[model samples]
Target chain A: MALNTGNKIPLYQQIKQNLKQRVKMGVYNEGSSLPSLRVLSKEFGVSPGLVQQAIYGLESEGLLAVQHGKGVRVLEKKSSESVAISFGFIQPYVEYMTFEGQIIHYAEKVFDRRNNFMIPKSSEGMASREREIVEHFVQNGVKGIILWPIDNDPNGEFFQNMSHRIPVVLVDRMVDGADLPSVVLDTHEAGCDVARHILGKLNCRRLLVLMDNLVISTNRDLIQGLSEQASEMGRMMDLTVMHLPITDFIQRLNVGDYSQVNMYIELVERQIREGGYDCIFCPQEEFLESVIIEPDMDKKFPELKLASMTGPMLTRSRKYNEFGVIRWVWDFPQMISSAADILQQWVLRRKRPTENVSIQIKQWQSTE
Target chain B: MALNTGNKIPLYQQIKQNLKQRVKMGVYNEGSSLPSLRVLSKEFGVSPGLVQQAIYGLESEGLLAVQHGKGVRVLEKKSSESVAISFGFIQPYVEYMTFEGQIIHYAEKVFDRRNNFMIPKSSEGMASREREIVEHFVQNGVKGIILWPIDNDPNGEFFQNMSHRIPVVLVDRMVDGADLPSVVLDTHEAGCDVARHILGKLNCRRLLVLMDNLVISTNRDLIQGLSEQASEMGRMMDLTVMHLPITDFIQRLNVGDYSQVNMYIELVERQIREGGYDCIFCPQEEFLESVIIEPDMDKKFPELKLASMTGPMLTRSRKYNEFGVIRWVWDFPQMISSAADILQQWVLRRKRPTENVSIQIKQWQSTE
Candidate 1:
């Protein structure tokens, strides 16, 4: 920290500018201690009083925390220097889910067009990996994190602590109690749209919804939407939302563990056959593949029609793709683009929105 | 017309009220000759001047038309009395397509809640039948008609004529050149969404879009969307949109002509095989049912994938419903409810919107 003190500009003010540059460059990160006043004073060949004045000015700008026994600490870096700052985007899964890559791709395009840069990482479906990746981002001093959280509330504490370090805009899967700004697709409304379709179009009275674990916010929201629609319909619809052992199964599947995939598919098929349901709706694509693979599904359950809500690649099956089950889907192109918009606004504007932005989910159904 | 002359109400006013009641009850319909002016005066025991004044009043209210030689005839029934009046809903097809009944059902529910009534008619997939239905609705003095037009531009002149007679709201299938208020789905955007998904997720450089005749607005919209997406991608994608002779074929299928079904399916199959395409998107369910029914479609074209768009019941094919061909669907419940809202607003307020209300289309896909 060499200051050009021969000029009319005071040594302390020059020192203050140098220190702010260090903060902007993330040389001293949030919650990290800066050099002692005496050390900084010596480094700058200045008096202790001048160094103290420099520190005080930075403090007034809300850039530092002064402590008597300890040293000054750097606060969160949300200042203007954060513009076009490096952002970390953690894809919820390490594995190549269809929309995951698209989310990264679309987000990259938008961020690139604005001359900002984003670094993407994968959680690898592991909470530990998620933690590690996030910590790496923080340590690297990325300006912000646009998080698409994984399920089971594994990183609640980590999210809260991370929020203090930098701005985080969640591409929300509806993590409750996080109290963070999020961009959420209105999955509940999507569920209601499904219910109305099943009742009004398919004329189905008994509806069975098979999906991921209800602990996940998206799954819960879809079920709540269905239940609310049923309630609103008033005796027109009866709904059953069944949650699988998704925590372990999806984890295994994520890691290429397919031994239990058959078991899960069979469980769903048995439920569809014996449950006396008029319609089945699955928002998760995990079981959709195996369940609809049977050649004689329509013949076995003549009265049963299935519906689904998911992203791209779930429409591979022609049995229901061309005819029976309806699907409600949200793609990465809209969702990720929306999240990127919110993230840019939150980071660039230096003011985060308190409310979560709810986007309408699209309805996909085929008619004969 | 019965008149109670001894009452405090004036004789001419009483005659006007009776004639107004006759018009309100549709005793004298649009474009039909009302009772002669002299005949009206003789029957009401009033002067021709009084009857003429009554006619002028009704004419001022836009309820009747008076010609120099011809007697008063009822004009369009788009007046404020059209409030809560019976609205005619004409489905694009006469046969039970899943969404057709649903549109009527949802529309009826909404209309019923407001103490209004609706009479639903099926066009029977015949241009002639569509014209007949509109003429019948007009003759019956239905205050408004919510028209879901048949394809092939068969009803363009009819629609323009009908708009003048009633507050007609077109559930637009992107019918161009028709200057009318419409409630339309944003199918062009939906098409672009499909294009982005194909490029971003499916990673297909060679694209093929197969559907009904491009003369239809919906098909054209979807194709245009795909083209625009390709254009926006700036040579990352090459799109080919092909049309089938859907007019005669769909009409025959509507009336249960399955003689050429296999031929049509084979034609699509040959195109898929010879095209060397990476993915195919079909927005019309009419061809989707025939295209994907080949159980060995994936085996035959192992590298090919498909996408589709339509209303409920087209997802019956479990093949694409589960895995490969993504589906973009719009349901009748939301659509009909929205259309009903517009119709109610148009008729009750005696004002019509010039812009088409575009509802977003939803995407459905499966992942491996």
Candidate 2:
């Protein structure tokens, strides 16, 4: 189509648009040189300067590359099309709002302004749905993907197949037997550190650890750490371990499900009465919170000191902090920033690193 | 340059090489379309078919892209330049030979034929040297990197900065606070499983865990798992944990350094006599082997039952098998394949995955 000079749009912009359309239509394919500026100017009934301006505009937009004495060339078709990176997480958006927010914050800072971030709606235990979301991103031209996968994900083969086509960064939990990059907390060490704090620093003679049937690596790591440290302390320490019968309480707690809280309280109370423990440790903040919130439960077990691994929600809560629970805070900002940094390399520079990054654990104790 | 008909090379090949040289010398810049077939044929005094063939050759080599209506265009000036992906690990080549071999095997299968793999010489605790190697790779335009980092890496900041330029996959170990992808064994679960086997199945009443102060996540995970499981089984089990004072002995052992083996044997002998343990758990295969190789140590402590995390080297050993040590085997093929799968996704597709991939632990109990 010919450029209309009488139109309000600038002459250069009109010419640029016309050329862009031709490139999109494959009239001038990628790496295909455009007609010389003189020929274009004569054909468009515009000045040679206007033609030059149009080419320069396209060049600035990354649709065309101008090489001196080599004529203008099409670099890419549909250059202005926004290619967003998609992130898939097992947790629903509302539950992982803080994490989601941090991802966007760091992604914006790292990615080019032209790029955007997309998060598909996902829920716990929806491995099939997670695979579908990933497939959808792959089908579309998503630049990259970040996934916070479900525990014991059954879609390992699907991810392995997808890995052949894109970069996938696992954020929190990882799938066993799926070789994917990840940014995670050193929960095992954190567990050991927490044990050291309780048994070494606090010097409680009798200790009780509360866990659930989630069978996650993090929980295992934490429990293992506490056990090893206690074991190392030998006859000086007496450790009792109890598994919470409440399945998926951590996931439920994230979404504000507290119907099972009473069940947890009763279980903890029974264990305390039987074991006569002086110190109690919960691998997750949600578990600790559930126990402490059981009105008069903390007072009834006044001799018991409590500690747990904290999340952003628990760390920020004034009421939760007031309970005087010792907590381990994960460095979320650093993790997000690190993920962004890795993304910058993979997406922009196209460099694939051969190492996993771990976010260090920060312990938060009541100053009072 | 004029074509030489007398040369042994085909006319089209000669033309392709000449054109390639010209492109390399900047006669035709990237994004610069070449002359029409007719013009090129006329200029070179060659048949139009020969010119067409030469252009197709360049196109196939990714140096040029030829459009149907448009002329041949330079796609990449240095298209034939080989870009190798570099892998850096803290362990020496001979020490981690099987692991290294597995990595290479899987990488070749997953990567494109055009890509090559490079592994620079590295040794344990050489964090500064590792950083320099990474820098060298970046400067050289290495496509991707695989890192088996040292524990408590001092170069976390450097690697994080490098990750902004490329995708990194951490193998076996990870750096805390660096956002990178990884493929690792779930050592924590293995620890728990081993503990269960020993306490429940084998009915070992007393346990001794012998470890070195390498301070790796695997050691911590194993120790934690063992401790937790032992604690859970309580009263029914007695556990003792000891750390060997030897530093880098694990690395040295892998490469066949037995100078410290005598020291280890002496230490174990002292512990066995003092503690009178019936079952001994070595966190690593090397440690187990070191203890078992001490002529008649098993006979000296007749009731001692041994167990360890086995690698390819140890598992294949007839003598090791004869020792009847219960072994936990990491599926190297699966781990490597998973890593390769992750690398393919990150490097080729540029898709960032959001979760970590853990290699499943396989148990190999002695039939005897």
Candidate 3:
């Protein structure tokens, strides 16, 4: 844990709180238009998105009336002047897509704060929105923001090129080329763990790894880590890697009805039967359903098994009864807290934490 | 189709038509912070989310620089800008947890937009961050947004409140209080269609309708529609409704992998053994998988047949060669376009669209 610099908090948050305190003291009347996201972001020298995230947080909390373009107007005085805290993701909760469930679980467990905290919907591939949604909290006067940047760029040009100007803790993804604090699972180790599990426990000869074509940094690292581990296991273990182009497949699924059998499903099943891949690894929850739901797949591909690299348990909804495919649960809270520590350092203008944050993907072995 | 008010045409489009316009202008002038989302939203009187969505679209196009806590800054001069548009949802794209193969097929089709029109990844539950992600596009200067608001609001307060600020259209869910444009299939008719097909075509008598819980408004509509149509078929039809609590099931599975085999997988197998329901109507993809994937489902539940409401073509997948699930493809584009129309009226300060935009959910009977 690091000290909270007064300015380390997001600009919008700083402004909103400043205004909120004034309101508590009767400095500004209620029903008044607050400073715009731009004005506040500029005053605090932070991205407008953080400001927007802060404001939206306040709006959701009923402290702000966002009359569309009319600007954010203070609705009612805070019963107390303490600013609320919030966090957000650019992507939807993991449950909706592949890995994680609703984001609220991870949020509740991590922040564990007394003030109102929020988890924003994850945006699909809209990197810029990732920044803005966080700012929404700042504008409405949130105390801090916890964000999950895209995994690919641990410290990329975006956050590095610009100053965060707020207390932001990065979770899940790393910001490449920058020292801003972040926390993420050791995907490389997770991949290594899965590979070791398959080669060691499963006693499988030919293993095939199937995944989406795009090398999302997280998945890529997992692949690399797995490949490395498999190699280290020596000639006794022979493995082949197949990168299936599932991007189009995912897109089609998004547009089409949720009620029919499609080609990709057929292909994976075919792979399991014809390709003779001993074990299948699916990174997302969506894929898990397909494997387990197939009627007696154990009979169809008796040699094949399933595994997954998943987010925290909080992301998984109550409906996931059978954990047939997922061999492990990558607890997101531990890593998220670590990432928050790094972000807090950046906000406080402290020298970046020297500790190298790494993750180990754990696996639950098949008892059978 | 309706006049392309905020289509994907970029601001620099004229440069393609006239090359002379390029070099003569410095355009954005380096380091100039682009107008913040609030400024743009206020200028256009659109919701900040719409603005942010547009801004993200533009940022993706390299038209803007989004700095954290600062307003959007112009990275380089732009020849043209993408206009902003607002959109809504009409139909739900549901998926079964076990049907991975079908998901791939659908993903491919929807995302094949010639590398344009990015749909943000969504988690299961609607996170609070949805608004800010949309606001990013507006700030970046995207031309429009097509959104599927969360389906949980039965009263449609989400769309009703947001429609006032932008050009929004409704998708799968429709509301009476808001005159939002919509594209939808008559779920009731679809249910009726299923009833007719199962009883009239398949000649099945006893039926069990396995539906997801009523968190989604469509779940309620679907149940109501199916009940009405089943009743119309008279005494020949014996209908028993069973709601599958998916949330509970997913959690158990996430915590322990064996929950699937011990709980859901076994329960499904047992249901087949009792053989009370000759036909099953699974309203979502998840339910469809649960009914069909048990190890001995085909053997024990020879009389059991299923009509799946949503999809990922689990049957078409290799796991089940005789996938008896009925398929339905939704008209997502039309639904999105209609929602855009409603949002447009709001953005332009015109009269709200008429409230009678009722959509009949469409169903495509599977030949397989």
Candidate 4:
């Protein structure tokens, strides 16, 4: 490790150089905890502040990391010798779901990056390109992956043809007829509950269901669930479920603009004016927020109601009770924690995870 | 690598197993791309659908990952990897910030998470925890850290210590004597600009500045900027700044209730009506939203006006815009891109970056 000696380099820089040299000399291996700053300060006969400065300097340099609840451990350095782990994510921003955050955070916490992990960018639309990227990671000797699959069940073959291989844990979305360990929300139940709440308490005769494209299993399952529930309810409910694809919606409303929302409200208003539907059941929070801004609910359709299948934000909102958003809890930490446990067992004992290891999401409906 | 037999275990599962084995054997590496389902299907003489199913299965199993725009890649198997470059965040749960989604999404796109990245969660009141976490990561050999430093530099000594050992990149905030590399939003400019927009154009003389705790540097900079601007304007403008720490405010105003918002409005009303303030400038979006729900500005104030630092939601809200909100554009992607570029240069090239790189923020005054 290079040591900074110039006074302009700061005292901490000088101390950090010594520590780096120790690491280079194999004094500190991955996962080994370092001495406390105070202890080091006393040993070096330097101020604790200087020691701390050194530590922070190393941390900022990516020679060290700081976690909230976990103590400092030697992270595997990303030297030329490090192994790589392949990962794929389907969500637009990977972090869209809080669950994703938990998974990523968990991965970072449990693995040694320098010698054990590698992640490449993954997206849905670029199928061929995604395949190339995956192959590149595999060729370079990636360990395994954690992915949120696309709706299609057949996408799994990409990894099958690879000469090299890796283990995988699915997050959020599920693959049909696949016997891989997976963590997914109970979207079917979530859909049914959303319909039941709107039909039973909100007293809606008709409803419009806004959804994403049905290419993925989640969309198919949600639509199927809602349709089945609606069919069973019969004449008691006149639910006209309108499938508005997000892409089409985006084209009209533009991303991050309210025009699409305004258009949706106008459409809803027209439906209400025509005396068709009594409620709008948005399948997601983005749509739910759209419904919230349309204040004409009291004026145009006095009896019409609105609700959606939403995450924690809906319940956390000040207008939660005012706006009916069905709570759908996805315990990310539990899933990740379990996956880690399973992965560790596999790594340490060479025991494969049994098919029975799966997580089912819990659903709750707010009566109020 | 494990091969699929299209049996009870499912073809996708078989494919996932094959990939997993290859990864473990160091055949597939992190940050490397993988083969597409189509190519894999052709090579294995299986249907494309089967390959897709396998990829999805792998995703569910946490063996493969896909990200938007970047396609599929290998990821680190756990949390203890090396972050080649660390970008500091100034706020807790930056994922919830107006532009944080884009920031993280893009970062995920370019960053090889399998190589390891450090994201330190440092809130204002949690200094001890922050220091401990930083130390742990530093000792682990993290390449760098992306942090949201604590307000008041509560962990100043800790950061100072860490800074001496590793390269730390500060995001969204700047520390006065710490010559660190930072990508920051010009909140000082944001504040002064908002104040000028409202006071100059809206003819708002009396104003109320609602500020929360200085948990992040952005918060403090925003308030400071506004105060500086107000002071510069001198007479004719009556700016009454209401500073409430987040904890104290939450205690006074129950989080779950909207009543607190009403109370704030009533207080502001009293100020405008009795105390003679004509406008209100909330430095943060939460406070801004709270103020927007109050009685109609045109009705209550008539001659009074309102402008605030707001998120994208407020800009999209037609009703909120009728009152006016300073649409502060926090370009998250720019910072992420910058960090990614910096990481590539530092980690991949082994070059020490010069300290202090700042991102400029674009402010949209409510001219409407």
Best by DockQ: 3
Candidate 3 has what TM-score?
Answer: 0.51
Question: Any runs in candidate 2 off by more than 4 Å, and if so which?
Answer: A1-115, A235-237, A246-263, A315-319, A365-368, B1-368
Instruction: Give lDDT for model 4.
Output: 0.53
lDDT string, candidate 3, B1-368, tens digits? 12123423332331221111111133335567655667655654456776676666556756666778988765654323212121211123222233221222222223221111222223233434345434433332232344555555343554466444344555566555655666565666677777777777788867777666756666676777667877887833477677778655544443444345456666655664564678777665443454355344766666667766543222233333346566554444444444444444433333455643545555655443
lDDT of 1 by residue, B1-368 (tens): 13433333355644654565455545666678888878877776678888888788778767787887866777765452332345677766432233343455455456544445555656656879777666655543355777887776556766776676567777856345567777777778988899888876778867777667647676678778878887888743477777777655655554445567778667767877676777877666555555554445676777777777755443343333444457787755566677777776665444566767788888843334
Quality class of the docking in candidate 4, CAPRI style: incorrect
lDDT of 4 by residue, A178-248 (tens): 45556666667666666676776666777777676656666677767777777777733476666666645
Query: If scored against the real structure, what TM-score would every candidate get?
Result: 0.40, 0.39, 0.51, 0.64
lDDT for residue A30 in candidate 2, whole number 0-100:
89
CAPRI quality band, candidate 1: incorrect
TM-score of 2: 0.39
Q: Give, for candidate 1 chain A, the lowest lDDT window spanning 10 residues.
A: A1-10
Question: Please, what are the lDDT tens digits per residue for candidate 3 over residues A88-161?
Answer: 33433332343332343344334323222333344445666555454443432333455566646433555553
Leading candidate by TM-score: 4
> Model 3 off-target regions past 4 Å?
A1-159, A164-179, A191-308, A312-326, A332-356, A364-368, B1-186, B200-278, B292-296, B300-304, B311-322, B328-344, B347-356, B365-368
Docking quality (DockQ) for each candidate: 0.01, 0.01, 0.09, 0.08
Global Cα RMSD, each model: 29.9, 23.8, 13.0, 16.8
Per prediction, fnat is 0.01, 0.00, 0.05, 0.08
> How far in Å is the alpha carbon of B173 misplaced in model 2?
51
